[model samples]
Target: MSERVIKPVGRGFLFLDSHPAGCARIVREMSGQVEQRTPERRTALVVGSSSGYGLATTIAGLARYGIDGVGVSFEKAPTARRTATAGWYRTAETAALAAELGRSWTFINADAFADTTKDEVLDLVAEQLGGIDHLIYSVAAPRRVDPRSGETYQSALKAIGGAHTTKSLAFDDGEPVLQEVGIDVATDDEIAQTVKVMGGEDWARWITALQERDLLKPGFNTVALTYIGSELTGPIYRRGSIGAAKADLEQTALTLAKDGVTAWTSVNGAAVTQASSAIPGIGLYVSLLHKVRGLETPVQQSIALWDQLTGEAPLDLDDDGRIRLDRWELTDDVQSAVRAQWESATQDNIAEVADTTWFLSEVRRLYGFDVAGVDYEAETEVDVAWPDH
Candidate 1:
């Protein structure tokens, strides 16, 4: 018998084991930042509640705030031959931690964009928690199928006005190698489809469904996460097809506000996650940003966002009524420094200008690798159990 080799698959990288140490580190970071002041008897319905910000938000709600609620995600379980997706393991670990804390939590594995999944979540809330006061939407997917028309739309990361070229990084044997990547201009059809897939349509649908069922508690709040990077990456990000979708999402939040749901669009800082990894030049930008601002994980940002939402103080909003968590990353000084590094970064000089090693480690950590105190050589259990609750 021979041992199977683990490696990168498509856009995702894989490792042999779920690093309990890394998970613990994230848990500690999130839990430590949670403010003692929170909404009383808080209950939440977290959409896409498996990985990245979603996972961090769920952990913060259950472990930090001690809120009991339901989590909806579409991650698949592991088999005898292959390990589960990182989200699966993270969810399993979250459930275990919640159980230890004596908190009631439920995980629903399903497509969040589908109406059936929304109905299932409503049923779970109705039967168990009665109603939810908070809804967090952090879904990031490449494609979405319109339940009404059965038309499948795929998202494109291309710039809107024209083709954009930027410096990117590729990992060769765990070393960062600079590469030039060009994003083709998005066609009108591509722009529409990208908007359909990534826009706030699904978020609106979920809120409407819950409201129709009378599942929304009084003063209920719902928030969706978005990103707006500095001007340096504006061509590919803030002004791209994805940016159009984010604009639509912001509009949806405003519309929902008219209905008294207190919906908000939170502009979060950059961090290594499954979604950010696919953006053409984001890795290099994040590495440079880390060099300037010190790397802050999604968990840290999620905790801060939650604090702002539930804290006793009045919620601070910009002219757009958006909570701008990206302020730290978008400050003039930081952007100036990042722009300087971007101008100078190349294959030969990226190591000196940016923190490539830390960036790569963070990317690998997304799939449970490169964590301290995790034994990669030891055999890991592929069949981990989901919590019965």
Candidate 2:
């Protein structure tokens, strides 16, 4: 081990700008629901379990629901070398905290996209927890490798046909100015590669492997998180390479449902996950939504995601049968409000316009660095190492 080095504390609030008490309340409330709903004997597996939405799902599972869990993540471990990812530290702390409650937890630091990693997870399940009753698929990666050909691939963003221009927010200085981003209208090979990387193949493989290994308990429920953005992100997201991946994911849900699993629907979760943040021109949209409700606190903005997860709101499906998280937020009334505000915004109208600083800050806080209560400067010495690779 390398000698510890002193690092300055991270400044500002971490996570969505919610009061510690309120955020704690939400966790406890959700935990109550989990305890009441899940059977004492049940177990769960959360994919992409190390960070962002995955971390939230794990928190809900362990902290709120009383269900023991196995988390699979492609996370780096803490090191004197500073190689660990943000999720690594958070998950480590979560595991430590969960242990105090006598709740079982396992953190796997292997690539979820790999068949080998899936097999290791199954082996662990058979050896320890027996089987999984609930599976939450929350993995979001920008790149993937084919299990067979060993081909590495990265996804792209492209315009539908011709180049188009749009305005995006600059959270650093809260302004929405017109800009341009383009994609190379994917070639057939490129489309296939995108599907290969972000597609449902890996998910299906995991399910199939667990089923074959007799590791999935009957009545197994699985959820895949996806997004269908508003007209604003259509060119860059909804109609782009990623959209194709999401379509495959949705279809895979129905296929899994047909496999006799009791619930296999994708939740079309809120677009606050790290995956959504990567979508071009999304910061402004988030800021716009925050302004719609006159939201001043981060918890209020974050409550929507939890609402969908636990509140059981009906999923809004588009014409093609995709759940529309973005469109639902962009309802006629909501859009009218956003558009009106957009029209009124000017170079000099920072106050009248949505403040995107909160939006950026919230996403950054999810990494567990910026939140208030946590002391970033203190040497935790607590191992933030990723699970064994």
Each candidate's lDDT (Cα)? 0.80, 0.61
Candidate 2 per-residue lDDT, tens place, 1-389, comes to 33233332333222222122222333333333332334265588888876555666676656544668789887655444453455666666667656866788888888898888888889888887899887777777878987777989887665555555555654323233433444456766766677777777888888888889988886576666666656766777767777777778878877766777533434342444456666666666666767775432222222333334343355444554443334446568877777776566554664457756667655655454335565544544434344332
Model 2 TM-score is 0.79
Per-residue alpha-carbon lDDT of candidate 1 for residues 156-273, written as tens digits (9 for 90 to 100): 9999887889888777777788889898999999999998988999999998899889998987899998889878778888899999999999999999999777899988888888
Q: Considering summed lDDT, which 10 consecutive residues are worst modelled in model 1?
A: 1-10
RMSD per candidate (Å) reads: 2.6, 5.4
Q: Which ten contiguous residues of candidate 2 have the minimum total lDDT?
A: 13-22
Instruction: Estimate the TM-score of every prediction.
Output: 0.93, 0.79
In candidate 2, position 380 carries an lDDT of: 44
Report the number of the highest-TM-score candidate: 1
